[model samples]
Target: MSNEQVVNLNTKNKKINNRQLVKLSIFFTSVIAIMLIFLTNVYIVKEGEYKVVRQFGEVVRIDDQPGLKVKIPFIQSTTTLPKVKMTYDVTEEEINTKDKKRIIIDNYSVWQITDPKLMITNVRSVTGAESKMEEYIYSVVRSELGSLEYKEIVNDEKSSRGSLNEQVTLKVNELLQKNSIGITVLDVRMKRTDLPSENEQAVYTRMISERESKAQEYLSKGDASKNRIIAETDREVTELLAQAKADASVIRAEGEAEAASIYNQSFSKDPNFYSLYRTLESYKKTINDETVIMIPSTSSFAKYLQGNN
Candidate 1:
């Protein structure tokens, strides 16, 4: 090849190789772009989530099954929502009871998204759904609690709130369904209920007063019972004493009568000897150291002394 011919051929060959290199670079770049698109469009759907596919900001479909999933590149998008239950701690709010007493209630709910598409259409996000659901929950809870007295909500032992949580859950679910919020409440409960700071001391005072009143009532009843028992005991003692006195009088009279009878029988059995003994007793009484004998006593005593009775 001549020198000029060689220079022209080398330049042409160099242009040809440059074109091939450009084509190769273009091919590699296209492959890399395709790979990047694939990677960006792909997502993994886990067991406890729902992958919502949206096209141009509008929901197209929901993939709830677990594993690798894909969507159309640059035209579709995926958002994840929890398929499992979630707990929402509702903000504490004050509600007036039927008795017009105000109290604060803090609640929490266990909820789950059943339909991702419907949820997206309605609430657009988990936080939005919770916000709307919390409103309904507060409304229902207030309505239900407002129909009850303060004591019924605070006093667990005497509470008429047997199905209070259930009622709230049912009413909230009804509201959600009516509004088509696509979320279902599994359970709703009052995590805490408290008296307002301004009213707490007053409530405590009232409760203490009630307890004191009950104690006083019991003491009064006990005192009345004690008095009744004492009265009954006194009456029984009086009756016993009266019966004992009557029985003693009857025995004393019987003993006196028996003694009189015995004396009469003994005197009747020895009348002359008894007369002599009586005369001697009379003489003994009449003959003291400074004694002077009376006429009738002297006649009987002299006759007895002379053995002439």
Candidate 2:
């Protein structure tokens, strides 16, 4: 080939090579674009995730079932929410009971998003859900506790089964029904109920005073019962002693009367014998081992003592 011809051929070859390179580059770029498109449009709903596909800020698809998922590229976006149960600690808050007693309460709640679409529309996120739930919790607690007396809430004997906690839980669930988030509260628990630091000392002092008053009242009642019992026992003993003395006196009088009648009858039966017996009795009564009985022996008593006619 001549020089001009050879140069022209070289130029043509260069153009062909450049065109091929452009085509190849376009091919590779297209392949990359397709891959990118596929990657962006495709998604996976994991075991514990709820997938939501939104178009122009509106939910179009929800993939709660765990598997591979796909959607239109550049026209829709996906977001995933946790399908597992979640717990949120409600901050400590002070509330006044029906009796106007202030108590500090803190607690937590377990909840799950039953409907992701509703969750998105209402709460929009887990944090939002927690915030909403906290609000509900506070409202329910305030209402429920306010309906109860301070002693009723604090007293173990009243609703020993923690019915107050249950009441709050039920009321919370009911109130949350108005929430479009479709959240079901699995449980509501009380971390603790504490008296405000400012009220603690005063409440404790009042409780102590009440307990001491009850103790003193019981002691006084016991003393009064003891005094009454002692008085009753003393009266019974006095009556028993008097009755025994009266009975003894009656028997003694009856025996003396019987004895006197028997003596009078014996004297009436034998006057001489009675006189002699009386003289003998007098002599015996007047005499002792150390007594001188010379005058008594010389009198009629001597004759009666010798059994003389």
Candidate 3:
């Protein structure tokens, strides 16, 4: 081959290489465009999610069924909201009871999205739905529990534990039905309802004072009963003593009368001998070994002594 022939061959090879570079660039651009289109238009709706497609800030449709999805490229955008039940723990709020007692209440709610389009129209997202539901929840809780006494709603072994929480949930659901947010509250529960720290001591003090008053009343009643029993016992004892004394006096009088009658009968038999016997008995009773004789010799005992002759 001549040098000119070699030059022509080299030029052909260079042209061929440029053509191949253009073809490669076009192929790579097409691949990048296809990838971009797929990313913007194609999406997957997972098992527990609802994909909301919006066109120009307006919700066009909701892809609720779990599968692959497609949309118009460059004009459609998507977001997902959970289709399963959700829970929101509301912050603790201070409330008042029907008795004007201040209490703190902490509660939670279970909810779900029933209408995806309505949710997007009003709530727009799960967070907005929760906020709207919580608003109704607060209203219902305050009204329902506030209609009851402080002790009525409190949980205790003695309390009947009524359906206030359930009623509140029902009312919230009822109220939420008017709003088109499409969230249905399954339940609302109060985890705790307690007196504020500042009011607890005061309430406890009042309770203690009431209890003490009742105790004092009982003590008063018991004391009155004890006094009544003592008075009755004293009356019975006095009556028994009086009756015993009267019987003893009657018995003593009868014995004295009988002794007089016996003495009269015996003296009627021997009057002079009775006089001598009485004198001797009197002398024996009145005289002792220490007695001194100061009587004249003419005494009645002097004759009895002379009889010794």
Candidate 4:
């Protein structure tokens, strides 16, 4: 071959190799870009989350399943909402009841996102749901409380309060359903139902006074009962003692009468011995160490002392 032809061939081969290298570099770059887009577009739906897929600010789909998921790259976005139970603490506010008394109510709610599609359509965002829930719950609580007396709300006795928490739960659920908040209200509880700060101390004092009054009443009743028991016991003892005294008198009289009858019968049988016994008893009665007797053949005690009769 000629020198010029050989040079042209070498130049053509170099251009072909350059084109192949450029194409190879472009192919690899395109693959890397596609892989990056796929990686970036992927998202995970955790066990307790529901993801809402939005395309250009509009909700297009909902991913309820938990695992890896992919969406349109750079065009769609995903927002995850908690599917587990959540709680919202409602703010404390003064509410009027049927009795025309104002009270402060602090409440909380347990809820969960049940339907992702409905949540997106109605609430749009979790924060939006929370705000809407707060409004709805406040309205429900106000309305329900407005129909009850302040005494019912603040009763310390649970039975006397008459299922207040259940009423609140039912009312809140109804209101949430009406507003389409797409949340299931598991429970609604009252943290506190109390009088305002300015009135609380007065109410407490009144309660204390009432409790003390009741205690005093019980004490008085106990004392009265004790007195009645003591009086009855004293009456029984007096009656028993009087009966015993009467019985003793009757028994002594009967014994003395029987003894007199027996002695009369014995003395009538032996007159001389009865006289001797009477004389001896008289002498025994008349003689003692303090006795002063005039002698001169009179007193038996003088005869015995003088050893003559």
Which is the leading candidate under lDDT?
1
TM-score of each: 0.74, 0.69, 0.67, 0.80
User: Model 3 over residues 160-206: C-alpha lDDT tens digits?
Assistant: 33477678888998988887878899989888888889888998899
lDDT per residue for candidate 2 within 1-309, as digits (tens), equals 899999999999999999999999999999999999999889988998889899988999889898888898888999888889988899999999888999998989888888888888888888888888899899888888888788786677774326767877787778777767678888898878899999999999999999999999999999999999999999999999999999999999999999999999989999988987887687688888898656465568566556666
Best by TM-score: 4
What TM-score, to 2 decimals, does candidate 1 have? Answer: 0.74
Candidate 1: tens digits of C-alpha lDDT, residues 1-309: 899999999999999999999999999999999999999999999999998898999888889889998899889998888999999999999999999999999999999998777778888889989999999999999999999998888888977665999999999999999999999999998888898999989989999999999999999999999999999999999999999999999999999999989978998999988797787787777787887655564476667766776
Model with the higher lDDT, candidate 1 or 3? 1
Model 3, TM vs. native: 0.67
Candidate 4 Cα deviation (angstroms), residue 109: 1.2
lDDT digits (tens) for residues 127-159 of candidate 4: 888888878778878887888777667667633
TM value for model 4 = 0.80
Pairs in steric clash, model 2: none
Single out the weakest 10-residue window by summed lDDT for candidate 2.
156-165
The segments of candidate 4 whose C-alpha lies over 4 angstroms from its true place after superposition are 1-13, 97-101, 145-162, 257-279, 293-309
What is the lDDT of every predicted structure here? Answer: 0.90, 0.86, 0.87, 0.83
Using TM-score as the measure, name the better of candidate 1 and candidate 2: 1
Instruction: Return the lDDT, model 4, position 125.
Output: 75
- Among all windows of 10 consecutive residues in model 4, the one with the lowest summed lDDT is 155-164
